[model samples]
Target chain A: MLSIKNLHASVEGTPILKGINLEVKAGEVHAIMGPNGSGKSTLASVLAGREEYEVTEGEVSFKSKDLLDLSPEDRAREGVFLAFQYPVEIPGVSSTNFLRTAVNQVREYRGLEPLDAVKFLSLMKEKMKLVEIDQKLLSRSLNEGFSGGEKKRNEIFQMAMLEPTLSILDETDSGLDIDALRIVSNGVNQLKSDNNATIVVTHYQRLLDYIVPDFVHVLYNGKIVKSGTKELAMELEEKGYDWIKEEADKATV
Target chain B: MTTITKDNITDSLLATVHPNGNSEAAQVIRENGFPTTKHEEYKFTNITKRIESKIQSFQQAKPLGLTQQDVSKAMIKDLDADVVVFNNGQFSAELSSLGEGYAVTNVTNSEAPFSIKDLYDDSYLALNKASFEKGVFIQVPKNKVLDKPVLLLNLVKANDGQLITPKLWIDCAENTEAVFIEQTVSQDEQAYLLNGSVEIKTASNSHIHYYRVQNQNNEALEVNNLLTDIHRDSTFTSFVLSLEGDMIRNNVTLNLLDSGCEGNMYGLYLLGGKTHVDNHTNVDHTKPHSESNELYKGVLADTSRGVFNGKIFVREDAQKTNAFQQNNNILLSDEATINTKPQLEIWADDVKCSHGCTTGQLDEEALFYLQARGIDKKQGKALLLYAFAGDVLEHLKIEAFKEYCIDLVQKKLGTNF
Candidate 1:
């Protein structure tokens, strides 16, 4: 579903992602785990087309099309979703209205009819159950004054509504408690299908227990230094990242 | 630019003064002359030049009449309101219809004792008091709740540089509820000057909603003043919408006469071209336990200018008063300008009062966030602007008017998002 070849990225002329390569087919869930400043978030940001990050070299292909050539909005319309670590607090814009606008825009791009108010509300109610979100939260301003868990759950609610083909969960488990982690992961697991792919970026192995990953890649110094299965996450959590950094230092030498 | 001095303008104003106008206010005008930019209130909205030229031609022209077609064309279709029309600054008996339970008469002819000295002020109010020939007195009797709004339409029909000064006095009695909507209309590209004033006294236990819409022609300049007195336990709410004009200045004042009164004043101004809008509001909390909330938002494009000055005064006797004021502005172009000032004066010891003002461009992060959600730049901008104005627009209780204002803002911003 997605392919990245020698992905070299930078922000403000400072190189971040030096050389990275990854590939994932449809229905596969990949977890990118690393310590602080290991370029895990940068990879997600670059994939979501954040304009601040300059792709100095390399290419990303999604379904045989140049993904980097499309605008962020076009990338979104093309079924690329990034659940932000910090969802913006847009005042005066209700969550329901924002989600409706996003859904209609994506549907319009795919030559589908727009949902009316009644249909949209009904669809929202059905999908809202996936994240266990209260109906009252949907009518309030988007993410304004929302708790950290509510913000993350709202992102999952949006993912369920948009039904993107490739979803990037950037630090989705950073601020979640055990209960919220279960709910967010449950929503993600339910939305997974054979026609879609998932990339979970996290610093802990706690979230892996809820939504188990098929492939685990340890990103160190802007490169994927290790690739394994679910055991890799547990191994890193038990032993910590010092040994991995030592190995990376030896490899650089 | 015609060469006309301040003395010449003052002489012209004195020559055509109304016969039944307030002599004390006329004397004050004769002494002070027209307010210049030196006056603190008129510093940014300096209209001495326009006033000098426009008032010259206005004093020389004859009073122009309006046809029913002109009134019909300017009326909002299907508004089901108690319509009151003023043509050329005079009450149009042929155009107005006072429905059941709505009473309106000429204040100049009313036997009820009235005094203009209590409402007099500097140049604009003084001028309005001196030249207001069509003073309307609209009263909603005790314990009455009107189902329909009282629509006051002031139309200026390209009357060869006529000066239209219309006056309105509204009294919502005790335990009554009413709505008043005042709108100004004129022909396209017609130069006219309007100095209008409205005085409203909301009695105790009454609820009043007043809306003032200034959708003037591009060649028109208006200076409007609204003075309201809110009694104990009464709620007085007002919304001012300024769409387009050459220059418009609004002066709004609210006096909380007794305890437990509430005052809400909101404004939205979307201006472009070389147009200008200035709003000055003052809320005097003279009684204990009164509350006042104000929010004024403006979006200026092209080379237009906007000025806002809101003052909240808590008197020494008014303990435990709560007042909040905020003025926010967005300048869409570099050439557009805004001057915002929020003033709070608290003489009481146990009062809570705060005032804040902000002037800047749109938030880049918010815009990019919207665009990242599949919305384009234009649509994203319109959405952000709509949200910015939502602080005031959300207070519009009337459903149709709220939608109308949303449509107007969307059209002005060039997007329907």
Candidate 2:
């Protein structure tokens, strides 16, 4: 469903992701994990077409389309979603209004009819229950004065509404409590299907406990050093990334 | 035929003064002449130059055949209010409807409540006093709460080099509540100058809300002076919506005369093209335990220019006064400019006063966030600008008028509200 071949990315002349090669088929989840400054979030930002990160050398293909060539909005319209770690607080726009515009634009891009207000409201109500979010929260300004948990849940609510083909969750569990993490994971699990994919980027293996991944790749110094199964995550939780760092350094030398 | 030059502009205007005009006001205008850019008050606004270049003569134009249909077309749709129409600053009795609980009369026929002596320093005020031939005096009796708002629809249809002076005096008696909406519309595209003034007096325990909407043609030059004297325990609130004009200057002053008075001034200007709009607001707290708040926002596109000068004064006897002022602007184009200044002078020790001004472009991160949600760049920008304007739009009390203003803003920004 998605492919990244030698994707080299940088920000302000400093290389962050160097020669990253990844491929994922349908119905599978990939987890990119490493210590701090391992270029985990940078990879997610590059995939989402953030203008700050310049893709210096590589091509990213999603569903046989050149993803890097598209603008940020075009990327979202083409079924690529990025759940921001720090969602912006826009004080005047209501959450419902924002979602309506997003949904209609995405639908138009997919050659589908736009949903009317009644239809959109019904869809919102159904998704609201999946994320355990209240209607009052959606009526207020988008993410304005929202709590940490509410913001994360709203992101999931948006994800459920858009139903993107490839979902990238960047540090979603960083600010979540135990209860919020459980609820968020439940929403992501329910939204998963045989034709969709998700990439979970995090530093801790605790998030993988709720939404397990099929492949776990350890990233260090802008390169994926090791690829393993779920057991590697448990092992890394027991021992820190020190052993991995030493091994990677020796291999480089 | 007299050719009016910049040096003889004042003489040409005074030659056509009304028979009831004040001699002292004429003397003041003769002495001060027209303010130049060197003057402190008119430093940024070059209204004299605009007037000199556009208006060749100060003679009144021949009256265009305006009727009730023209007034109705310019009115806000579905607005439930008492309507009064004016054509080129003259009251059109055939086009107006006098509702219950209020009396409207010509200012010259009635006992005028406004004096030019209080505002002797301004040549524009003197010009208005010396040349205004037609003015309205509206009185609301004591203890009467008006059921509907009063809409003063002033329509302008003038030839080149013509001048229109619209004057109004509104007196709300003690313990009364009322709302007034003053809207200006140009019937033609002729270049003209509108020198207008409004004097409002809210007695003890009265509450008044005044809304002024300026949506004139591109060739219209306007200078509006609005002064309100708020008495003890009264509340005076004003909203200025400047949407379109070639050169527009609004001078709004509020005097909190007694204790327990409250005053609020809110303004929003969305301008494009070569339009220029200047808002100069002053709030004076004269007695103890009074409060005043002022907020003005502007969005300049194209090569448009905007100026906001907000001044708040707390006198020595006005102890425990609370005054706050803020001015914000957004420049959409490279050539668009905004000069904002917030001046606060407080002589009282026990007072809470703060003033600030900010001018910048729209937030790039906020725009990107909206774009990331699948909205295009243009729609994202429009949404952000509308939200930026929400700070002042939220203060609108009338729902229909609010929606009307929102529609205008949406149309101006080319997006949905």
Candidate 3:
């Protein structure tokens, strides 16, 4: 349940996302594939309400509410989750504590009482299985001294805990080994429901193999130049974004 | 090398001398005299300003804020601790109780064989003796493992007048185990000075856990020192959390007297406004096979300042010694400053010793990531600060106290997160 029209955003007065538009319905997974500096991340960041970027034009709506007007925490409360390409290593904040705060914040927004500690721990145990994360890891600081794979897996753990209505994962599979990719993908797959949506933002097409997207859009120069089925991801991966770049040049000519 | 030799720190310290120019403690300061900057220990933090700006009013004012009930209420949950309450610098029997297998008695002004006979430095130690109100002498008998942590709650409510000296001595006997928790707090905004000393002696095979919490009033200033001696195979853990007050200085020295002795120290200091905190720690590896590890972290905001100088000295005969020390700090405002030094002096070739110190701002990249995840700047910084302080907080062995420390730090940061 998301809609964007003529989206124009910038950072420090420099144009990034210009005249871009996209729409996605509930329960649909959309993959935005773009080469470097194509404004894919800016779109994701603007949607999550990062303050650095100025929304010079266009408006976004989530379930018909003005998205741009909401604060970051408000967006988080409204079930907008972002999986950072590089997860932050929050020293001294145990994984369990971070997730608990996030889950309770989300739950509070929905008018739900915070989960009791016992109930919370059990829920964590159940979720940890989805990502193959160890209990010992949960006991330590969030992502501190964790391997790249562990950090990626921890992101899925958080997504599981918050159970957001929409999750925008930016390169969740960038550093994962095949096994970790399978585990992370499986986690995202299990957390998906018919009432929510997903946006997979990545530099590679391998992640789409496990949780196949409903629409594969090739993004170039702040605009989605082409839209196709899952085969499009395979085609882009096989020949690379050069084909998309060439096609954009041909259009300009 | 003489006792309390005067140095350059005292010359530069002459400016801030107040109107009266003295307290019973200041008289001691003038007599015992200020140690120069060349004094190895006082090198990093220039305490001259503290000496010259000394307010005579602090030493005479009666302690303010807390009553006996307030202290008893704050004792550790379910702990059968020997409760000693010090209101300002004076010990209150009406507010104290000694636990089983232990004896807690006030070391009154008239007490015999008082170390008052062999004084250390000026008013810092002597003021406690000249007009000292109360002190505790704790003795845990041989081989007894007391089941609870001793509670020493030093409350300085508020006062207009002078200084409060809280004094303590603890002797945990051979093969005995004990835990001690001390809290220094003030509720009123009255300006005062606190000079405190806690001396501990651990016998062979004994285990001691010491926790110190400082949450004094915003107008208060304090200088506290602790000397701990560990015999063979003894273990000592000391953690200090400094949160409030205008100025705070802490000195902790651990002397490992026998082989197999161990020392673990972790401290967290959070300062804002014009508050200042200086911590000096010395871990001495005297006997062979002794080990010591120390980590102290601070978060400074506004114009507040922090100083950390930790020294690990391994004597020539102390072979196989393992000593590690780290001091890290974060400054929230550009005006905030941290002067940190971690020093290692190892004479034994077989020893493993390393010390590191870093002063920095919070990671911008990490902050951006949190913001991109829909967390605002304030919440993101709070998360990182908590994470920074979390490194030391993790060493807390008690769950409730650990949570208490985290909450206290968060409140000090003045953020809802």
Task: Candidate 2: give the clashing pairs.
Answer: none
lDDT value, residue B17 of candidate 3: 33
Candidate 2 ranges with C-alpha deviation above 4 Å: A242-253, B1-6, B12-16, B108-113, B116-120, B415-417
1 or 2, which is superior by DockQ?
2
Looking at candidate 1 chain B, the ten consecutive residues that score lowest on lDDT are B109-118
Higher-scoring candidate on lDDT, 1 or 2:
2
Tens digits of per-residue lDDT for model 3 on B177-248? Answer: 888888775656866667788778888999898999987677767778787888999999999998777778
Ranking by DockQ: 2, 1, 3
The candidates, ranked best first by TM-score, are 2, 1, 3
Q: For candidate 1, what is the recovered fraction of reference interface contacts?
A: 0.51
Best-to-worst order by lDDT is 2, 1, 3
True contacts kept of each: 0.51, 0.62, 0.45
TM-score of 3: 0.84
Residue B32, candidate 1: alpha-carbon lDDT: 81
Model 2 vs truth, CA RMSD: 2.6
Error at B110, model 1, angstroms: 12
Q: Over the stretch B287-390, how does candidate 1's per-residue lDDT look in tens digits?
A: 89999999999998889999999988899999999999989998888999999988788889999998888898987777767766777667778778888886
lDDT score, candidate 2, position A171: 89
Enumerate the candidates' DockQ scores in order.
Answer: 0.49, 0.68, 0.42
